[model samples]
Target: MDDPAAPRWPARATAGLCVVLLAWNTLVVPALPGRPASAVAANVAATGVLLAGARWSGLTWAELGLARRRLPAGARWGGACAALVLAAYGVALAVPALRPLLADARAGGLDGPAVAVRALVRVPLGTVLWEEVAFRGVLLAAACRLLPLRAAVALSCAVFGLWHVRPALGGLAANDLAGGPVATGAAVLLTVLWTAVAGLLFAWLRLRSGSLLAPVLLHLATNSLGVLAAAAATRGG
Candidate 1:
């Protein structure tokens, strides 16, 4: 029999820690010198802490829908849809009329092999995992518990968009091609809109798969293709 007076300490502690970590990474690290890596590390650490909390609370990875199980059908369909969206974006950017609007869509200048290495080693196994944990696993899940599904998804997307604002604005301001306040502002606005759409799509994938792994893989694939496309554009290949 369970103890009548036993407190739900583990759950409370886990929830509290998650909040603190999110606040620290979101509000504090952006102002630091080494921003991206520090923020990413903090996010990874927060995930680890949350996992520990889950263990203490008698929750398994499977209970959190974090188990690594293959969903071949979902993977195939999601991959196709993601590729289609990316191709549409690519085609739009390639059009002469849209070139001015997509000035920020330049490639990364990485070689083909380097792009492959970065996608496999740097993005999927690193950034995607850390980002998915922070955005989908922790933030979205917590928001869903407190708010309606739509509200949670919207708020999460807003937060995700805001998180990119600093870097996007800074890059635009620093770019020689992006001149004047009007141009910079337009670039930033476009970036924000794009990120919000991507955020919503990722969230939808998470919900549809009923597992974080699917979204993580999808995110990795999308980013990898983006890098490759960027490289190709830079080389005029």
Candidate 2:
């Protein structure tokens, strides 16, 4: 529960920032001309901006799920989720055919050290940090105030799904999918759909653990290990 002194944000204003955050992540970031690696800097900055915006939107630390007391619970849940995902990735790598499915063209040409850096550093800081903090942290917290729990989750997750459209564009060839406008469109749509489903689970982590760190660590493991899985595929795993 929030402290009595915590300021309650107006539904309208909090909701407005939710919309802006969604659009900014989906529409604005992808359109900026730069290499994917360079986006890490921008996303790092964006994380701070989102937190500041959340506070200004009148969300308290507990509302944003960053309260220090909740960290232990969050870590347990997040760690368990991360372990499961890592095991699944291990299984996928063990299967010859499934390796192709794990291939990510973005990680295609990196050397050993480069891939290590990406999995250990880039994916965590660049992709997962801002995303969990944005969709699950600020947006979800703000949304819950204005809508039912399920509806608030749906709003955040749906947009979170669409947020991958641009990144998936570059990944189509990685899966060895057919090359055509229609095929690419379908692939992108499938990515969005699955990611939206994944978003629901991430939301559950945040709500269940009552801490943003839960989803953040889970997301970090997913994306970071994903980079390793992709590199393994590149090496004919």
Candidate 3:
């Protein structure tokens, strides 16, 4: 007979909480009034929720891949990821078909300096930290413990796809030259698919490096570069 008093993995509870948190961040928050502000609030809340849940489930920072000892290595890998993203954006700019994605539909008030400042602050603080911390750090770690590595990566990638649904849809609104609904839907699908692949890569980095810093840096660099690239492209770079 087995002793029923021993502590076991909280797989079911974690999964449920993950679903709720993901839904709130992706579905609910996007629809709320105040776009960028709501986005910031949603991300912060999601991080707090994930951290609280991790503690409740007896998970440590290391288990979450948040060990700070690997920061140096993570920074190096992050630089590589950023370089690759910029190279890809360079290609997109060269190709006319891809350039449409970088079209600047944003309101025109912010100039180069303002845009750079916003990207510097927003990318690392609001976009990168909470996302990499929650997705690659907390959710990926939790899924890995519950499932095989391959399965965990796939599931986490799927969850990551879910995370971008609102943003993918929102992109259509921010696009000045977006076509009809069908085209918008297809664009959203492609965005989700691409981000899913990116999520897999981030998860791989997190697992291989055994540090959340890798994903954090990669996430931050990619987003910051994106903001800068968009600004430049819109200004005819």
Quick one: best lDDT, which candidate?
Answer: 2
TM-score of 2: 0.88
Each candidate's lDDT (Cα)? 0.62, 0.83, 0.73
When summed lDDT is taken over every stretch of 10 residues in candidate 3, the lowest stretch is 1-10
> TM-scores, in order shown?
0.67, 0.88, 0.82
Model 1 lDDT, full chain set? 0.62
Candidate 3 local distance difference test against the native: 0.73
Off by over 4 Å in 2: 1-15, 31-34, 173-178
TM-score: the better of candidates 2 and 3:
2
> Which of the two candidates, 1 or 3, achieves a greater lDDT against the reference?
3
Per-residue lDDT tens digits of candidate 2, residues 1-237?
234344445777766776776677677777767845667778888899889977866788998889999999999999999999999999999998788888876676788899988887788888888888888888888777766779889988988898888767757665566478988899899999999999999999999999888898889888888888988797784
Error of 3 at 43 (Å): 2.0
Of 2 and 3, the candidate ranking higher by lDDT: 2
